[model samples]
Structure formats: structure tokens, C-alpha cells
Target chain A: MSTSLYPLASLPQIEKTPSREDGIPDGLEEELRAYGCKLIHEAGILLKQNQVAVATAQILFQRFWFVTSMKQFGIGDIGMGALYLASKLEECPIRIRDLINIYDLLLQRKAHIRAQAMASRLASTSAHPRTEFKYTPMSYFGNTFYELKDALVVAEMQILKRLGFNLTVVLPYNTLVNYLRVLGLTSREDVCTKAWGYLNDALQTPVYALYSVPTIVCAAILLTTRHLGIGLPSAPENCWWELFDAEWEDLWNVCGYIMRLYRERTSEDHTRVMGMVAKKGVRQWLEEHRPAGGEGH
Target chain B: MSDSAGPSTPSRKRSRWDIEDEEAQLEQAQQPVKRRSKTKSAKTSPAPEQTRSSAAVEPQRTTAVYKRPPHSIFVPPRTLHPPLMPSRSVYCYERLNSIEEGSYGVVFRARDKETGDIVALKKLKLDEEKNGFPITALREINSLMVCKHENVVGIREVVVGDTLTQVFIVMDFIEHDLKTLLTTMPAPFLQSEIKTLMMQLLSAVAHCHERWILHRDLKTSNLLMNNRGTIKVADFGLARRYGDPVGVGGLTQLVVTLWYRAPEILLGGSTYSTAIDMWSVGCIFAELLLKEPLFQAKGEIELLSMIFKLLGPPTTHSWPDYHTLPLAKSITLPPPQPPQLRQKFQYITAAGIDLMSRLLTYDPEMRISAVDALKHPYFSESPLPKHPDLFSSFPSAAAGEKRRKPYESPPAPVRAADYNLLTDFDP
Candidate 1:
């Protein structure tokens, strides 16, 4: 069973797959062009920086695809649907109207792809004015309580099988919250918020399934404290140390990618940076040394 | 109360029995008044069928035809008793007896007093703490209600319990399931006996597939047989109802028992269709003929490898979407293994081998369905078992009698770990 599961080193990098409207296959380049793959990559980086938000967003994305695909509903609705489902599946459930508003924000004419025109045409036919996409009561989507029940049970069984059924999966949020209270780390409020959010996002990635929830929470706390330049704990527990060492490199990579995206925006004039991203494509502009913006990677 | 009729007159006798004799007398009385009635109105009149229905002797007379359904088709009650509380609204002749524990649910021998017939009452325990009745059960009942066949378990009533605690179902009971029968057989069923069982299994499944129902769980244990050796497929706990292909439906990962699970399911593909069920049918066929389970994988990954070892690795040619599955390209699978037909199952006949190959096709579109498999050569030649009509009926067996065996259980698989996924595979 373990052999079938992909290890982190073995996982294939997420690449854009060729897709078409019906059954026809389109070229990868054309598909990428149509989807604004460049912009999505930037968003992924920005999300990775704020790990919690990224995890939440990804959860939304996967759940949306899962639910819609299961119901035999259209895949075209997945982008918005993912967020809608994710918001609930994640701790923060967003309102449908607000999510549609976010869809309008995220999908405004960008480096590539213009879904606004298509969206407006679809929206006109929608019975609800508030919602950008027409809504159907796929009670099965809400009926996820059953599926989740199964998945959670499976998850426990999986954890037991992998660890020889010994380790207990202590819930992360409670322990993290408790630790935060004890440490009195609430002084740097913005840092705390960002760290908490990043930690939440880690769950959306497959990495969550790799280790116990407590290990993740501990790593999140350590990363947050380190970024703040606070004195580390004198005597770190062996379990905490083990998680920190194993994940530090991966976490650093994620944090660096996120930090670069944010610093690029904050360093330059807000309007100017936005314009540069609009023109060069966020991915091209953020590259270490590509004559500011270029066609090729 | 037509007591004024004269004795010895044909009119009197006819008038006493039917309305025909009185029709003429009534017409004679109304003829004189017809001229006035005609002047009054002629705008609206009832249709012939409606008139005949109205003039029928009694509404109860027509209901008798419906009381006993024809041999070919049977309609179980649609609005069953509510789960749990054992509602008397749905008729049950007998009280709850000791439970007959199966792999999935608790079964009991029950009786129906109205017809003096006994039934097997299966109490399905749904985890209400987690959710409501499992979707598998929902799909099974939804499809089974519409399915009318003698080879399938006749769902007498779906009694919805008041709350989570008390839900139960009352169904027609047979004395023995196939697993019990297999124990009594001297050895593995002869090729002919195997053919008869497969035919019955296929007939039931074909009926289900025609109605867009997928029996996700299909194994020997789920198959029940009467003393006369007629097999009826039971246990719809893992069944699913799909109206169209690629519809947004639930991911049924834990569909079949690990030994009988298909490779596609093991790949973590959330939504493989009826082809998954056919794979289990193939497994059952091989098991019956070989007298042993096939491709026993202790865990999910190992289970997958075992399947690959037997059937060979699925290529784009075999399963077109093999590469595109979400989890397909993730793992770096070893070089593809060739199909090892002879090494694993050396004893099965060549005809059996052909049938197994057809039914176990990796490509769902290419896989032979139950109905098509029935037309296979395995059932074409040699001695076919007696059909339903010729088979002797046992009053006690069909009426749900208790033929207790000294508690024999299925051999538990020796595995490295128990990775029980909560999807509806009971074993």
C-alpha cells in the first residue's frame, strides 16, 4: 500500500495538461495560453507564502472538482465551485455571493485568458442576479458528510497502517492555539495572523497526509517564531526537532517563493508594480534574472 | 336486492347474478322518458373504458389481479415502513427472532401472517452519528425497487426506522446462501454447476445494469441459494445508481472486497463506473471454478500489484484513460508485468479462461456486461442446469426456514495491515 503512494521526491511536478471544450484535444501551448497558466503560477507562489490561505484555496479547488465531477455537473463551473466548497471544507466558509465577487476579482482581464465576456453571457441567463454562475441544488455536495465520514475513517485506518497503528493524531488547531496562549505570541498580531494562515494552508497540500497533524502545527509555530527573530525554545522536544529538520528545507522553499512575490509588490510603488505584473506577467517579472519580462522561461 | 324477480324465468336468474338482465328492463322504462331526456342534454358522456370501470362489479374485484404479481415481474412496496421502530403499517406476520449475522447486516427469519409466508428480515445498521443511511444502501434500494426478477432478492419492504437506532428491512428469505452451498459440495462445482450459477448471477446483474444500477459489491457470500440450487443475488449495500456517465457522483473507493477489487479502483480513481462491478464478477467466476480466491492483496498497494500480476499492467491500449487518472502518473510504477494466466490459475478450462478475459477487460467500454457474458460459450454447450420451472421448489426452504450449521466462518486473509477504507465493502 505504501509503495503505491507517491513519495515527495517521486511526485511529478504539476504541469498544465492539454484540454478541449468537448472531447477534442488541444495543444499544451494553446491550453496554457487560454488558461493564463503564467498568472496561476504567480498566484500559486503568492498562496504558498501565506500557507494557510493557499491550503484553503487548494482545498476549495479539489473539493469543487470532486463534487461537481461526482454529480456529473459541468466542469466549467469548477473554478468558482472549488472556492465555494473549499471555504466550507476549510474552517472559513465563504458566502456564495462573496465567492462570485472574488471570481470577478481574480478573473478580470489579465496577462492571458478573458473569461469575463463569457461569464457575462452565462450570467445573463442565470436566474439569480447575485450569483455569477447559475446555482443548482446538488444536495449531494452538501451530502458530503457521508463521504467525509468515509474518508476520515479511511484516513485513520491509513495512519494506523502506515505507522503500525500506534501513533495518535492529535488535532493541530487546539494544540497550536493552546501553545500560542502559553507563549504569549499575540504581541506581534500581523505576524501571528500570517503564520496561522500559512499553517492552515499546509493542510490543503498532500503533505498533510505525510505526517501527523501535531508535527505540522509544531513546524508552523517554529517557522512563525523564527521569522519574527524571537529566541527559540531552550529545550526543543525530540519530536518537534525531528519535524523541523525534515520539513525546514521544504518550508523555506515555500516561504521564500511567497516572500519574493510579496516583496516585489511592496518594494515598488503599488500602482506601478500592478502595472508591471499586468504587462510582463507576474511569473516573468518575478523570475530571478530574466530581462524583466520575456516570453520563455 | 332485486327480490321481485319471478321464479323459473331466465330474466329472474340472470337479474340475480349480473346487471345484463336488468339493462333491458331499465331501458324499457327509460325509453318513454328518452324523448324528454334527449331535449334536456347530450353534451357530455363518459368514455368506454371509464364506463366499464364504473359498471364493474366491485373495485375489490380488479385489485385481486394485482394482489399476486405474475411470475416474470414482481413489485415490492414502494413506501416501506420507517426505519428502526418496526412500524406495523408495513405488515409483518412474525415477531423478530434471533439474528442471522452475515458479512454486512444482521438477518432474521420472519413470517408474513396475511399469506402464511415467512421472510428473512435484514437489519442494516446505518451510522447516523456520521451521517444517514449509506448512499450504497440508498442506491441499492432505489434500483432494487425498480428491478423485478426471480433471481434477485425480492425486497418485500424497506422499513425506515424512526431514528438512527431502529432501521430494518424485511425481505424474502431463502434457507441457504451460495457460500453455505459451496461448503456442502464435495469439491469445486463442476463446470456445468458453475455455468448455472454464473447464468443466474449474470441475469440478476444484467437486470440491474439495464436500470443503470451498479452492484459495486458482488461476491459468493452475497449470493443466496434455495435447497433446489437456484441462486438469487442479495446484499445491495454497496450498489450505486447512476443515471448518466461522468455525472458528479460520490467516489466509491471501497467498492469491492480487497481480493475482488479491480485495478482501476486501487489506483484511487474516485469514479470508475460499472466496469468495477464486472471485475468482481470475474473474480467470483474464477473463484468458483478454481475453488480458491484469486489475486489476494493484503493492502491497497499490494492488492493493486497482485491484480497487475494476474491481468498484466493496463496500457493506454487496454485502458485508454489509464495514464490520465489523477493518481496514475503520481507513482513511479515498475515495468509492466505480463499476464500470468497459467501460473496462477492453471486448472481452469480454456472456455473459462476466455470468459474471464472478456469480463475482466480493463477498458470499461470494452468489458462484457452480465447479459453479454450470459451468451458466452461456457453456457452454450454441455449440460445446462434445470431452468426455474423444472427445478423443484421446497416449501420450507423458500419460506425462510432455519437450517443451522455449526458456525463456520470465512478464512480471514493473512495481511500485513488492516487498512479498512469506509466505503461499502463489507469484507
Candidate 2:
């Protein structure tokens, strides 16, 4: 009674490969996915200021793209949707408006850092609606949260459908902590922080799609150790990844996809962000099936 | 019924029952194959051609199906959701008895085929506009999976039928829910019994809160007592992780049902925490003592007034942030009323009243937590709380057989039983 919940069809495991057959053009898949991942981090940066991990949100964004291809919906719509669902799942329920407001603020901060005065002003005014301006960032976001007010709500349904309604998202963060302890890095605060960062970044990749949870945990640890020039006891004696039966190659592949994103930031946001998002019949389908706003309770 | 019958009867070349038989046959034929490789033994029939022939019959009957659902617009998905890998346990079981209709779905006492053990089968129904299964069910499933306290209702596995549309969440079968017992029990429960029940309820809430989960909907109907007198918290449709993600824009104004809703939430406080569950537990405690809801108001406003009249108006001292909360300022305060717990519930132990006041304290931070309430002298004094296994007065508990009032009403209609009684999970 508190929230609208519509049961949907269970989603099949989509092929991990990004291709035209999966909806988005080959290059478009990588570009839009990168934009989606950026949006998640932007939300993450906002959450981090408040001391909340964006792992749940990132995983949701990754899972959403996997289940529903980019061709069906735009990157921004799913990104906003992931943020909305993550807030609730993370235990701090935020309204979509708050997400939009905070995102606007973050985008403004980013623009201010780059000294882009117009973008910053537009961001600031919209983020603070009562501060004497009304230019919302809806068009910039392909009208995701702005034009489609319940886009998050609709995307939430799509997520549940794809997940077989399984909302349990196991991020590598928790398992990474255990793995960190096993590798004697718990005392090395700086090294552990580096690992945690990698783990957060890994959340945005297809790591979860490619391997199990502990395996990703190993990959994050591996990336952290390699980046920092840390050494580990070889093989048989302290073969930690083997403890979880995780293969290093599978872990490397998780690292590969994430490492590719480091170069994706320079891509044009407009090409990836703007596009038709509400899957063809989704709006009319929404109009017909959308539950009334106020619940009986 | 006639309007649908007239048009569909002529359109359907076969009788309705005939279509149903075909559907059942289809289920039986595909059951093993649906399992893919796991149930190789069940897939003795290599009749792929026969399977296709029967599946071909499905489209016609499905098209001619009734658009009218008696109580709701229940259009099961015409295009099935793609199936994920087959789960180990598909819900292949026989329903033994109807337990009751829950907040969202119909619950049944069923026999789990593989284990040959009794379990509660919650079957979700499509809600209005035929938007598929309820997300509330998903919430409950996810919540149950994370929590493993003895006092929490545990989901065994998600059991889907041959089709993804028809599914059941297998859960531990608690013999009776508090609502059933409270409504039907013939005698006043001994104080010890009350203590035992409250202890279980509070423990469950405390455990959930510890894990950062809030059982937002905590009322009599959601508390189920097993035959051993152990009451496990059931129905997490409204429950969610409550601490970190709470920020300015994403907070939900909707919360617990009217009677059990906390003052802070009712007063428009959006950042309500686990204290809300304590407020509900307080209401449930009052119900156990008084045999009715503590504040059964006609609406939210009335409920607020009733609470204020009972506990006194919210003051800066009582609720430090009272004036600061947006909702508290929305309405003018009614004339002050003195606290009346002693006058109203005099029959309850003074210690019990002491606990009640603490549980319902206006200041959420100042309110008694489940952990603290469990340690209250009320539970320790006089008749010490009975071990759940030894205590039994809750309807489904074995001892209940000696004193439980038999519900004379025939089995209530399943879906249309009481919409208000329905919670979430299934649409």
C-alpha cells in the first residue's frame, strides 16, 4: 500500500557481449554504457559526501543494462532509475526529486570546477528551484527524471522483471573486506582504501555478469595490489582466490572491462545521453497499467 | 459473468473446462522438460512433437480468455517473462489447507513434495490493470533472504510452476497469525503469555533493525505464531533498509498502517527510523492487553487526535524536534490533554503501563528500543515469561487447542476476503 509494486515477467540471462543484436549499436553500447556508468558515479559522488556507498546503485545500473538492452531505453533513464532503487535498497529512501536535485548540484559543481559558467549557473538554478531560475536539466538528461516523472518507477519495474524480482544485490565490497583481511591488508589503511575504490569502480563493470561475488572481490584486490605494486605469497601456500575457487583469468576480464572505462570519459555525453528511452509501447503500456498514485493505506 | 460467457462461449470452440483440462495436460507434459537437465528422471517423455502440438492449442484458448477478473483486472502476462535458469525446487506440491489471505497473497498449508514437510505457500495474484506480480512480494523475498533470526519468518525457496507467471514463495508454516488468534481466542491471555508473545515480537524487530532492516508494516496480522508458541515476524512487503540512503528527496511519506503508524510519521516526519516499528509493537502490545486496537481512528487526522488525547500533545520537551517537524506545524495543536495510561489501562500491570509509555514515547530517539523493552522489568517480574515451547495460547500453538475458540465462520472467500486485510508481495 505504501508503494506501487507490479509483478513483471522474469528476465532471461542476456548474453554478456554487447552487439547490435542486443539493441544498441556496437559503439553505441560502449558509449551509452560508459555514460550510464558515469551517471551512477555522479550519484555515487553525491552519496559519498553523505557517507553512503554507491555500490548498490552501480550494480543496479549494470544489471538493468544487462537485462534490458540500451536500445529499449536511454542511459540516463536507467541511471536515474538505478539511483532511485539504490536509495531504497541502501535503506535510505530518497525521493526521485531529491536525486534530481542532488544530481543537478553535483553537475553544477563539476561545471564550476571546469569553469563552465553557463552550465554551472543552469545547474545551480535548477538544483535550487526557488533561487530565481527555472531551466531544468531534463533535456540534458534526455528528459529522464524531468519529463518522465515516474521514469524511475517504471525502470524499477523493468529491473524487477529482469532480476526475476530478485532485489538482493551482493556487491563485492563486503566480500572484499573479508578478502582484504585474509591478505593482511586490513592494517594497511591506504592500501585498503585503494582496494575499496577499485571495488566501487568494479561495481560499474560487467564483473558481476562475468563472475561470482568472491571472484570480483579477488579481482578488485588484484587490481589494487598491481596498481600499488604490492606482492602476495605465490600459489599453493596462500592462494586466496583459490579459496573461493576463483580463476585469475576471469578476474582479469572483470578488470579489463573496468579499465576500458578510464578512457571512455572523453566521449560526447549528448550522443550517449539523448535518445528515445521509454521502450516503444512502454508509455501507453504505462498509461494503461500504472497504478493510481495514492495508496489505500 | 454472463456478458463474458456469451461472447467467449461462442468464440471458444471448446468448453471452458475443456481448455482448463488442456492447460493441466500442458503443465504435466512440460513439467519435467521445464526442469531442463536437473530432473532428467521426470523427463521420461521424449515427446517433443506432442509438446509442440499441445503448445499450439494454448494460443487460441489464451486469446479467448476472459478479460473480466471478478475483483481485479488480473491479466496474466500474454508474453511470458523469459525464464532464468531453473531453480532446484519448483513448487510441485499439494495444497492441504488455506491458512489465510495475507497483506497481498493467498497463503496455504501445503506439502513440500521433495521434503514431504508442511510449508506455507504464498501464491501471488496479478493486481489491477494486469501489471504482473507484485513488487512487494519481491521485497518480502529479498528481506527474508537477508534475515535469519529465529523470530523472523523464513522463506525456503521461490517455487515457480511450469510457467513463470504462476509462482509460490515457500515459507515456514507458522500455525497462526496474531490477527487470527486475537480475533478468535476465547479467553484473556495470561500475562505470562502476553509477555512471551511481546518478547518474540520485539526480539524479531530488534534483529531486523540490527541488520538495518525496518519491518515498516508491523500489526497483528503480520505476526504469525507457530504451534510451539514462537511468533515469527512475517510479511516484509513494506520492510526496507532504513539508514543510509535516506536523504531529502527520496523519503517515503507513506509508512505503517494508520493504527500502528508512529507519531513522527503521522506528523509528517520523513526521516522516521526503527522507532516506528516500536510504535507498532506498542500498538500490538496494547491490542494484546485490551483485545482491540489502541487507536482505531476513522482516518489519519482522527488517529492523531486520538493519540494526542491519550498520550498528551507533542511538546518541545516530550518530542525535542516536535515544532521543527513540518507535519507537526501543519495543524494547530489541540488543547493539551494529560497522559491517561494509568486511568485507561489500569488493569494492566503498572510495570506494563510503564513499558507502554516508554514504547509510545513521542520522541522517537527517547523511545524504548526492542532490545531495552525485552529487558523491561515487566517481562522479568511476577510471572516470568514462558519459554515459547512451553507457552501456548496463540491459536496455532499446540496449547491453543485447549483454549482456542473455534472460528465458526466458514473459510472466507480467498481473493475478495478483505482488501484492507491484504498487504503486499502478490499484487
Candidate 3:
């Protein structure tokens, strides 16, 4: 009877590596990580622009890449599929055609960027990108498009399988709004708007992945109130944090994760992150014995 | 230790806790990376055991954590969101027999092995659907989550089979739907009994509408009743949260079973409110009174004519916006006829007729709101609605649970095939 149930706890997601021999190169893997972040952000923008609820779409994007790596699928198609799935789950269905059309347009634009780069880099390359006026469903699957529309359909299914069809994703936005109302912050428009902004930024991080909705909401409130220099009751089960049963440490972790996301995206730590981290013992094992190691480039 | 977890034995059977302890001991050996890779290769292929493995292995605890072996394209980071702690699946529930299916899933009456409680297990249709999990199933969960009124059927929990694709939404097992009661009851419902059922239906609808949600599909089949005469609104596959009719969030024109659909919907009107549901309630009220459908037409045109025949056709005076309606120019309906409430259903009272008229009005704007309909003079006129405790239809709860024949929908004589070479398919 409890509405707040996460069914996926019983169905743990196993990491799928196609083959150790064909493992992604370090540069490409790092690029895909950055690409995953960029693609989900773009997906967030697309959902907002198209009037689809942004929370579900953002959550779906974050959950999708966790199931499968970018090496096995196109991030664009998967992100679009994630958005489409979110729209449906949220009970605000955008036409599937509308989503497919948007994806096709993005593909066309990416093609244009590639064409310019190719023209600048190679004078005599024969495989010139197709310069279609507009992308139709037919043209999208044709030529260099390489049947991406079909891939989107297929990848969506694969993503769901990886998720184990655990579609019940709870958002902190609703809980935050209710908590704000309960905390009597409705009249405080400035504070409410600031908290709303923090929540949006928090959506882009693993704050949701690591913490529960209550923790994320409490984290947003804490960050917002601290920025405004507002005095708080500073006690558990009081006016602000009392409504939630979340740990103060988890709330701080939620804030910390968002801060890390910001730092990772803007700083030069983007490319060097993989080599810099303590990958520990596992990669060393693969490099020494696996024949496919150095030839990955 | 990884050697003993052979291809034949399912890791699902092998508890993750056991593996964790063993894996910890293996890693503590401090052997070269080769020893670890050997373990990695062992895990990479977890055998093809399809049945009864609780493969709830958390890769986060393993070296798979952010460990990208440059050799494999498929190896994912272990830091990826930890999946929900895998729970025991639907395999635990012993399915007794198939109950009737509604919406996109087939439901079964099952017993929870752990609790021994009888519950309705709904298995959603997965194959042939390119879309992953059905949206209707999600909406049902969403609606049931928010609308916790006693009159609304609650979803107990969702369980997945051995595979994630095979999901089952478990709900409290109600023995009888309204359709079953309507057919099985020997005599027609008493006036007070009818009022009781109507009040419960309206209460549930009002609860949904108050939350800005519409139960798009509201027919006798979708309404479930326990022996206690409590009506729970069941299917929400077509239901949605609606704002103002002209609001920026557009609504799909397609919804509701045709028999219970409102006139505005059938006449090609796009936007709808709770009025459509009220109209269905009116149809249901009439059916409760007569023990059959008020308007059982084969098609849209025929259904509208049935409405026109009884209530009289819509005039410019009745619906000022009739001219702008999409069906106004396309379909030439028959001219208006005088209302015939008294002769058609002679049993209903004058107050009942007035309430019926208000509910079945051609203009949706004039339709009786659920809140207002409950306070109508019909209930106050003679026999007040009997208390729910007194309106029990079954002799006992056990009697209600006793399986009768499988429910069969009333045959449509008009649409029934009367195939004959000369008579039906004449050349």
C-alpha cells in the first residue's frame, strides 16, 4: 500500500562489457563520460523547450547510462528515448514522432559540424556528408545516418532491460514544494526561487543516485537558506528539516555531489580524471595479461 | 572460491553476502593482477541459468567499481547508480488461477507465499510492445498512489518475474466487479440500494476530480465492489490530470469506452473536463435502473441518435456553441424531437428525471457536478440511500469469494454475425 516503493533493489544491474579485447580506449571512454553529461543536459533543455516535465527526463537520462555504457549505444538516441520514456511515465505524452523528428534534426546538425571539420582537415576525402535540406524519417535512417531511428527504438528496449523495468522514479521537486509549503515558506518568494534553482542544479548530479528524495530536498533547503543567511531552528524534527527523516550527513553529501558536478564540468579535470583516479589493481591486471590492451588506440 | 560457483549453479541461489565474504578473502590474498583477472573472467560469464537465481550482485562492492579494463567495450563503471536492493520476485507468489484482464495486462488471483494473503497479481503485456514498460501501468500506479480514498482501488506493490520485462502489479483481490453483480443478482437493485451504489461511485469520481484527475474509463466493468457494498474505481489506463480545457498542456482526444463516452466527445469536441465522467455516471445510473444500457448503439451515429431519440436533439438554444462543433457541418443529425423521459423509463421519479436531465444535458457546461449531484432532491424525495453496511449484496464474505462462472459480456444482437450466403453476404 505504500506508494514509495523502489522495485529495483531486488534486481541489481550487472556491468556489461562486450568483450575485454574491444574495451573502449581511455580517451574515448573519458570523452563519452563528458558526452553523457553534455547529452543529458541537452536532453534537459529539450524537455523544457518542448513543454515536457524536466524532472522525469533528467532522472531518466541519469538512470539510462548506468545500465549500459556509451560504447554499446548512441548516447543521443538513448537520451531521446529516455526523454520519451519519461514523458510517458509522467503521464504527459509527447508524440513519438515529435521526439524522433527532434533527434533527426540534432543528428543533421551534428552532421553539419562533422562536414565542416572534414572540409578543414581533408582536401581529397571522398565520403562527403549528405547535405539534405531537412531530415525526414526516411532520410534519417538513410546513408550516413546508419539507421539511427531503428537504433533508438532498439536502445530504448535495451535500456529498460538494464533497468529491470523499474520505472517508479520519485522526484524531489514535488516533495520539496510540499515541504516548503509545510515550512510556511510560500510567502518567501525569494527563498523559494533560490531553493528551486538549487534543486534544478542538483538534478544534474548523482545526488539522486546516492540519496533519497527526502535527503535531496533537505539538502536543497539547507543550501538555499545558507545562501540567504537565514537563521534556522538548527534542530532535528523542527521547522525546516523536521518534516524529513533524512540524515544531515546525507543532505551534505547531496550538496557536495552537486558542487563536484559543477567543478568537474567547468574545470580542466575533465580529460585527466581517469588517469588521475585510483583505478586500483583491476586495470593493472588487464594491461599486463590482455593482448588487446595497447592496440586499443 | 570463485571456482566453486560453477556454470550450473545460479548466482541467484548463491547469496551476494557469501560472495562478498569470499571475494574479500580472495582480494586479501594480494596476488598479482592475474589472480584478480581470473576472478573477473569467472564473473564475466555468470552462466545461462534462467530459473531461480537471485542474481542481485552489486558490482559496486567488486573491483568493477569504476574499473575500466581498456580491453572491453562493454565494461560499465561500478559507480553507476546502485540498483534497488533486489527483492524476492513474483516467483514467490503462487498463482491460483487467471482472473479477468483489464487494460493492457492479464490479472491472476494469487496467494503470497510469505504471508498467505490472497492478492490479485496483474501481469503486464511486454512482448509485441516496442515501448518498454506500458505507460498505462505507470499511470495506474501514479493515480493509485495519490488517490488513496477508500473508494479507490489501491495497488499493493509491483513485482517483477525472473526477468524485469515480466512485471506484475499486485492489488487487493476484490471478488466481484459491478458487471458480475449486475448479472448474478436475481432481482434488480432496490431504489435505496441503487442510491447507495451511485453515492459511492460519485464519491470516488469526486475524489479523483478534486485532485484534477479524470477517470476517463468509467463503466460497470471497471467498477469493483466487495461484499460490503463498497465501490472502488479500478481501471485508470485512460485517466489523466487535466487543467483548464484551453490550457497550454494539450489533452488527447481519444479516451473512454464508447458506450460511456460523453456526447461532446462523440460530437468531435476536443477539450473535456470532469463533465465527461458525469455523463458516464448518468448512463450508469440509467443502466442500474433498467438493468441494461440506456443507449446501446453499434456506432457513433447510432449512439447519438439514441441520445437524440430519448432526450431530444441539441438545439441552438440548448448548446450555443453547437454551430462551431466539428460534427455540426460534417454529420447531418436528425431534427430535434420532444423529450420522452416519462414514457421510456416509467419507473424513475420526477426528481430522478430532473437529475438525469441535468447529468445527460447536451451542453457539458450545464452538466451536474459530482458535488452538486449528491445533494439532489432525488435522494431526499422518498427513500434515502441505504447505509453501506445495510446494502450488502452477498450473504457472507465467503459466499462472495465463491467462484461463479467466468464473466461473459452481454451479446450485441445488432453486431452479432448472422452469416448466410444469401441473407448476410448477398452478392
lDDT of candidates 1 onward, in order: 0.50, 0.64, 0.63
Per-residue accuracy of model 1 over A155-211 as CA lDDT, tens digit each: 322221222211111234654665566667767786578567655545333334233
Score residue B91 of candidate 2 by CA lDDT: 44
Model 1 TM-score (2 dp): 0.44
Clashes of each: 27, 13, 20
TM-scores for all predictions: 0.44, 0.57, 0.64
Which predicted model would earn the best lDDT?
2
What is candidate 1's CA lDDT for residue B107?
74
Ranking by DockQ: 3, 2, 1
Off by over 4 Å in 2: A1-165, A173-197, A200-218, A230-297, B1-91, B96-103, B127-135, B161-167, B245-248, B330-337, B393-427
- For DockQ, candidate 1 versus 3, the one ahead is 3
For candidate 1, write residues B1-427 as lDDT tens digits. 1232212223322333243434445434433332332222221223322322232233233333422211111211111111111133234446546546765577777678788776787766665433223434444554566565778888776553444344456677776666555655545676666788888889888888776677777888788877666888888877755645443434657678788777777777876777777888998888786676766568987877677767787887888988867778765666777777767667666777788999878877798878789888868766664455454333343344545565978667644235454333565
Winning model by DockQ: 3
Candidate RMSDs in order? 30.1, 19.3, 15.2
Error of 3 at A237 (Å): 11
Summarize candidate 2's per-residue lDDT along A265-291 as a digit string, tens digits.
432344223322224423333345445
If both were scored by TM-score, which would come out higher, candidate 1 or candidate 3?
3
Instruction: Rank all candidate structures by their TM-score, best first, as comma-separated numbers.
Output: 3, 2, 1
